[model samples]
Structures are given as structure tokens and as C-alpha cells.
Target: MGYIAPESPISDYDRDVVFFEGDLEELDFEVLQKGMELGFILEQRQTKTGDIEWVARDVRKFVAPPEKKVIPIPTSTKSKANPESPVNIYPSSYRTFLEKLSDSLKSIEKINDSGNFEDAVFSLLRLLGIHSVYQYSRDAQAGKADGFFILENLAVMYDCTLRNPFEEYKKDQIENYIHKLSNKSQLTIETRKADGGRGSKTLQIQGKSRQVWIITKGNTRELLVYDSIKVKEVAIKDLITITIEHCRELSYDAEHLSSKLVMLGD
Candidate 1:
């Protein structure tokens, strides 16, 4: 290893020449020997202090690399859900949950849709260890939340309903429900905080959470709304498709399986 720089002021005539100044080690010798074919001329010089220093002159002319073009990323504009979107396929720890979700959805379809739908949803949430309470208290705005659940410090207030044809009226109703829930949740948090700092202790994170609006249908398409706005259309045709798609999204540590060929000689 040695110091490399222009031998002198980089003039037009000597622009290609670069100088290396220092003692050359074994590593330096190996590197110089390998690069000898690259037109790098190596020589030795004695300094005034009686020390030997290596000199390497690069004969190749330097050329700058081409500048890369800047590409701008397109922003999202509430893109419609695509059922044909690619999903990852791999082994996951949540494989059992995916199976159970698939089985539950199928079983619910076989039973009475209107009567058993809410119960089934609640059961599924319970299985996921999400504690739910029905008909929770609303704020002063009379925004009625269908249900409430506590996830760690996140107070999730949700509205569960069965909508047919998925019209604007249903959307408005859900929006109203979310408004009420948000107001109540905020008020509750403030009250808890005022009461000897109990609120801060209970809800470690203090903020309005996104409203979960689960809109189920017997024949029409299924939808999952957040804060009264439609997010996922559940556009897939069957439960297996939905399960696989959702599971793929949920799976972060996906493993890709591959096979390799080997050759042997006698």
C-alpha cells in the first residue's frame, strides 16, 4: 500500500501519469504484479533520508463514468384493489391461523348468513386474542359505535354491519359511527388522564385509532373499511384466494424454495 496522486500539476501532456510514493509491502507487490498488464509502470526511488520509495505511473487515461438518470416514484391516488395482484408463497408460522380463517369463512357461508355472521366475526377476533365488548358507550355527538376492543394501549372502536349492494347510504352510516366512536374514545382518554393520571397509565399510547368497519355481505362483494373509508374490496371470488392473498401480505419472513442440479464423475 502506498500514497497515490498526480506526479505533478496535471498538465494536458502528462494527464495520464499518476505517482505512487511509499514503501511497497508484500500486498503492494502482489497488487502491482497483477496490475502490470493494465499498463501501470512501477519503479523505485531513493529519498534524501536514504529510504527506498515505490513509484507507480498509471499510463491509462482516466474517463468519468456516465451520469445516472433520476427517476421519480409515482404517488398513490386511492388505487382500486387488484385481486390478480401477485402474492408470495412460502411456509409461515401463521399457517394455522390462515387455515382456521379459511375454515371459519366457509362454515359461516353454510349456516344462516344474517344470524351467524356477527357471532362468527366475534369468535374469529376472540381466537386472535382481541377482546371485544358490544354496544360500547358513545361520546356527546351521539356517534354510535357497534363494538369496542382494547388492543394493548390501542382502544379500537369498531362498527360491524351487513350491507347489501354497497350503496352510499351504508357508507354515510359507517362514517357517522366512526365519528361517534372517535369522539367517545378521545373523551374517555381525557377523562382517564384527568383522574389522577389513570388515563396515561391505562392507554400507554394516547391518540385516536383508525375505526375498523367490517362490512359483510351474503351475495355481494366483501369490504373492509378504515375510519369509515373503504380500503380493501375483498375482490377475490373464494375464501381460499382471500386467505392466501391476505396470508402472503401478513407473512414477512417468506422463504423461497429452490432445487439445484449436481454432476458426478466416475
Candidate 2:
């Protein structure tokens, strides 16, 4: 019903106060009276030109809307695979190995050996049908990745952490890995003994769909910062679930798991 006068120079009034002109309609007058009754202070001032102005003070403060809660997707149980599905077939030894790995990961906190954790993760990936997986040597140069695997067109460089609460050094290691990725097109990594014991191999990663991930048995909320850099943090339990699903039906291979990781990050 009233307007903030354009010609009302702010310099002519006190800070946090707005000047309004024109007649207040019935509804507007009622609202103003109710506001004053609710402790809002209103003042009237006469300008040098005899113009009457209304100054409203002590207006309501702005309150921000509450943040939306993010509910994590619960991990699902493995479903029965079709007997006719060719992918459902696997060797007895492979099934035994999967069982053992899954058991070890369940009590990961009890395992003081980081090497065992890393090995279990690497073996699990291989068993999941990713043929191009390689584990990096512990003696490799600084800023080197712990391991990497190729999933069809996607290449993922990853590091493993056994810390339950997730330490800062692990995060620093991931940042270093990101920096390494940014600087190099090809990464030289040692070949695993299972892959013919080759001395070393150069992975050409430039122009490929690349992702950096931290496979940790720790809290993953800390890794949210890397989401913008295409980094994913997978909890140890989730990895075990993925492995179980794969072992059951050959459902989640490296490419499928990588895509699932992207979804989890989002």
C-alpha cells in the first residue's frame, strides 16, 4: 500500500531504517498496527519540505531455511542368480576365496596389518572379473597410487586405508594422487605376479574417463571434499557387499561397480 520513496536519500536517514511514503490501505494499516503491538517500533518524521515520512524500525530478522537431511542408501542383500546365467558359474576355489576375504573384511578393525587389508581389496577386485588390475609396490616413489584398475573405458586410481576414523595423512595421500593425475598422462606401475610377473607397465590414462577413489575401513564423510575432483570414497562394508553380489551372480564387475560408486557419491 506504501512504497519506499526512490528520492529518499539513505544518507538522510539512520542505518537499518527504511523510509516509506503514500497512504496505508486498510489491510496495510492493520498489519502495521499489529507489528507495533508485537514490539515493532514505528516512527513518523517531517522532512524539510514538510513531507511526512514513516520510518519502520526493529523489523523481523531474516531466518535461513533448515538444511535438508541426506539419508544414505542402505546396502541390500545379495539376490539369487538365475541358474541359466552363464556368469553365475564360478570355480569352487574362487567361492572359497571370496568367503575368506569377506570374513576378513568384517573384522577389519582387528587386523593390525595394513598389507592384509590392501591385499584383500586387490584380490577382491580381481575376483570380481576385472582383469586389468595392478597393485603398486610399497617402495614406489612418493605420491604414487596404491593401485589402479581399468574398467572398460573408465580408469580408476585408488588407495586403501585401514584407519577406523580415517586419518589426515590418508586424505593428503589422495590429494597427492589427484595432483599426480593432473600432471601425468601415463602412470608407470608394477605388474602383479599373477599377471606373468612383468617388470612394470605404463598405463596411458590421458583422454580416458578417470576416477580417483579411497577404499577405506573408516568414516567417509571426510572425503566429501574430493567429490568435486571426481574422487570417490567407498566404505569397506560397501565393498564387501559389492563383492558378495558379484560372487553370487557376477552382477557387479569393475565398470558396474565404478558406476555404482559414482551414484553413491552423488
Candidate 3:
């Protein structure tokens, strides 16, 4: 929520990068504190074009991350960026932004659900480079995989737990749905192969890879999820591939239980 102004008697890094920008500046101190505790230094300023540019002041608070990064770029707005080219982010700015967004998604604020959900998701997807609509959700239908992705020949179904009060999703329910999809998809291939289906060779696999993603119900607040994904994992010194928040029942909305995919792209 707090960003370091490069010239605010802070430093001469010209790193005036607003990593954790947005309405998050008005977010509660505790929520911001929780983010910092999760090892998300949300307001890091990366010196993209200068020497003696940046320096790490300290390790105020850190915590283990529990969800995917959610980066929010205004699609309705225009940028100097090229649509055909990849999106570029300064290291510091990206890291903090993701942390907040991911946390917001996990907490499921009503804000995210408002307006166009697809636009928000798609915007983040483009940031993640995991494009393609693998599954679509008919929110009225429960126990069904709402949305998914077909990445690298593998399909991932998600029962998005992104909802209000920040509650932990029921693992059993998640497991049940994903298992069903895995089995159903596998069976279709088997039955088809036996019936002389066209792509028998492609379908003849011992098991298909399945990824079960759990996004959130909705959020109206500024989410810094995109800021988190780019953080460095201690053990690997590399950014974590998957982050899981601690499972606890913070809060819930029964109606918005499952409705999105968790995309993992190579």
C-alpha cells in the first residue's frame, strides 16, 4: 500500500516506479501488513535505467505466499506498450504488485466480481501469457469446472475459491471435482480408442496431466497478486512456481464457490 518515492528524500535511484499502485494505497494497514509478513516487499523500486540506482534497505516482514499472482493493467486505458510485443515489468514493481493482487483474489473481495470478470481475468492472463479459454463457467451450475486452460496439451480445471471473508476452500470438494474431470477425460479417450477414434495415438496415454486451479470469488479492492509471483523463493533463489496460502476459514460466499482456472504455463 505504501510506495517509495525515489526522490522523496528516499534515494536518488530514479526508481520512481510505483510497484504497488492503485486503490491499494487506501487498503487497511493490517491487510498491507499481512502482505509484508508474507515476504512481499510490495513497494520495491527497480532502477530500470540508471547506475547507483537502487538498494535494498531492509527485511521488514516476510511470510510464505499461498496463491497465484494477480496483475491488474487497465485494458480500457492505452499504454505505450505494444499489443504484439510482450508486457514488460520492472523487477521490483512486478513483485510487489503480484503479492497484493494474489492475496486479494484469495480473500475474494466483492470488487473483483463487479464489472467485467472476464476482462479482469483475461488481463491477468495476458500478463501471465497463458491464453486460451479451456473452460467456461455457467455460475448457476455448481460442482462443475467453471473455467480451465489447455496448455501444452494438458487441460487444467479450476474450482475458483476466490471469494469473500478470505476462507480456505474445501479441499475435499476441490479434489472431487478435479478427480472427476481427470477420470472423465481419460475415459473418453479410452472409449474412443476402442471405437477407433481418429487421434488414437495422441489419446493413448497412461494418464493425462491435470491441473486444478482455485481462483477467488471476487474483489473490489486493489489486488497485488502479480507482485508476489515474481518474488524470490528462499530455497531455490528463483521465483516460486506455485504458491498456496495457509488453509483457514477466513470467510466464504456459497454461491461463488467454483468459477475459474489456475493457469500454469511453460
Candidate 4:
């Protein structure tokens, strides 16, 4: 696409502050056509900001994907846990562990307050260095998110839980979130690298990943993790030895889960 600047100057942060400055007139038919399918508009439009008044139009567009976007995943990927997978997360020592886990999940964008345990887990993941947002609320004011974390270049949605959990519940919950995330969306797109060596598949391309995080809650519990082209479900449990073992194999920070299930009595 091409453009005719206002002659003043457009900085990189134009989108952040300018609201709308893209000169769609410069956009070629091909680019505009592609942009439209990608959720963009090339026609002229107007808007009013707090104080800055400016006439802007052109190819600048906001791509809002459908509310229910379907996400697909590969088959080779599967949960790695066996009967011998040792777990180290338990209620006895979960408090100290969880306090630390909470500290690590600082990037969580939203937290569900109702019976939805996933929201709480989203917040916890952000503390654990996993970037995530929740999208359960459909209100216009509600932001876009359904417990997604920044994994690689893709935003992965995850079903979250911390209390009253077992492997069966987690497995079902994961599938539910997967269904929710895949309700609607454009075909898979690729995310380009800064170096541009090999472009990776993007959030728009293929399907996004939906993960399950069972916050260690209460005492010992049982769980499972299963994934395939059809559906993905993970069994979850609170047995410390089992959790630690699974963490070792899955490579997730076992220490985090252990800290979360810390119970004073357990």
C-alpha cells in the first residue's frame, strides 16, 4: 500500500495516538482487497478524539476477527506423561509455592471472578512469565481474550483452575476452551520474523493452541493430558510427586504448581 502523508510527519506510534491517519487512497486494489478479507476497510471515515482534531482517511484499518474464531492444531503434539510421571505439587507446601507462582504471572491481562476458575489461572500464568488474556465477557466494553498467553508468536488460550480439580475435570475443561477458541476465525496466517529468514505460521493461519493449567488446590488429585487432531484434553491431579514428575517431563516449572497448591493443613 502507498500513502500521502499530511506533510507534517507520521511517526511509528501513529496508530497508538493518531487514531486514524492511513491514507487508503494510496492503497492498491490488491492490498485493499487482501486487507478487507483480513478484516480491514479502505473507504474514507471520520472520528473525533479528545482534543487532537485531524482529517484522516485511506487504508488504515482495524482488523477485528470474528468473535468465534476457530483455531486448529497439529496431531504430532501430545501431552507427555506416563504412569510413572512423578509429581511434587501438594497442598502441604503449596502456599509458599503459589505466592511465588503468583509473582511470576504478572502479565495476566484479565481475571475471572465468578465460578470460572480459568480466569484465575490466566492471571496466575501471567505471573509465571506466560502472557495471557481472558475473553469470556462478551460485552462491548469487554476486552478480547479467553485466557491466552504469548507462546512463541502465537496467543494460546488455556483453561485455568486451582481448586476442586481432578484429571477428568481438567480434560473436559481444556476441550471446552478449545471449542470456544475455535468458534470463529480466518484461516491460519504466518508471523514474519524480524530477520525474515523463515516466516512462522501466524495466529490467523492454522489453529491456535489452547492449554490447561490446574492450579494445585486442596490435597492429592488425579489427572490426565491427551491431544490429537480431533480434540485435546489433559488429565490433572494434585499429587505432589505426580505433579513434579509431570512437570519434569512437560518441562513446565514444577516449582510453580507446587507453590500454588500449598495448604496450611495439608
Clashes of each: 2, 0, 40, 63
Q: Quickly count the clashes in candidate 3.
A: 40
**Poorest stretch of ten by lDDT in candidate 2:** 19-28
Give the alpha carbon lDDT tens digit for every residue of 102-219 in model 3.
6655342334452245334433443333444333434333555445544444454444443444323444555465455543534221111223333211122134345544454432
- What TM-score does model 1 achieve against the real structure? 0.34
* Candidate 1 Cα misplacement greater than 4 A, ranges: 1-105, 132-145, 153-155, 183-205, 217-266
User: What are the C-alpha RMSDs, in order, of all predicted structures?
Assistant: 24.9, 24.2, 21.3, 23.9
Best by TM-score: 2
Q: How far out, in Å, is residue 137 in model 4?
A: 1.5
Evaluated at residue 170, the lDDT of candidate 1 is 60
TM per prediction: 0.34, 0.52, 0.30, 0.28
Candidate 2 on 92-191: residue-level lDDT in tens?
Answer: 4655887886786566545567788788788777766677888886654356666888776667788887665555666677777776666467977775
lDDT of 4 by residue, 220-253 (tens): 3323333521222222222323333332332243
Q: Pick the candidate with the highest lDDT.
A: 2
* Range of the 10 consecutive residues with the lowest summed lDDT in candidate 1: 257-266
Error of 3 at 142 (Å): 2.5
Provide the global lDDT of candidate 2 against the true structure. 0.60
Alpha-carbon shift of residue 89 in model 3 (angstroms): 23
Segments of candidate 4 deviating more than 4 angstroms = 1-120, 138-146, 153-155, 167-172, 180-210, 216-266
- Candidate 4 CA-lDDT value: 0.36
Residue 183's lDDT in candidate 4: 46
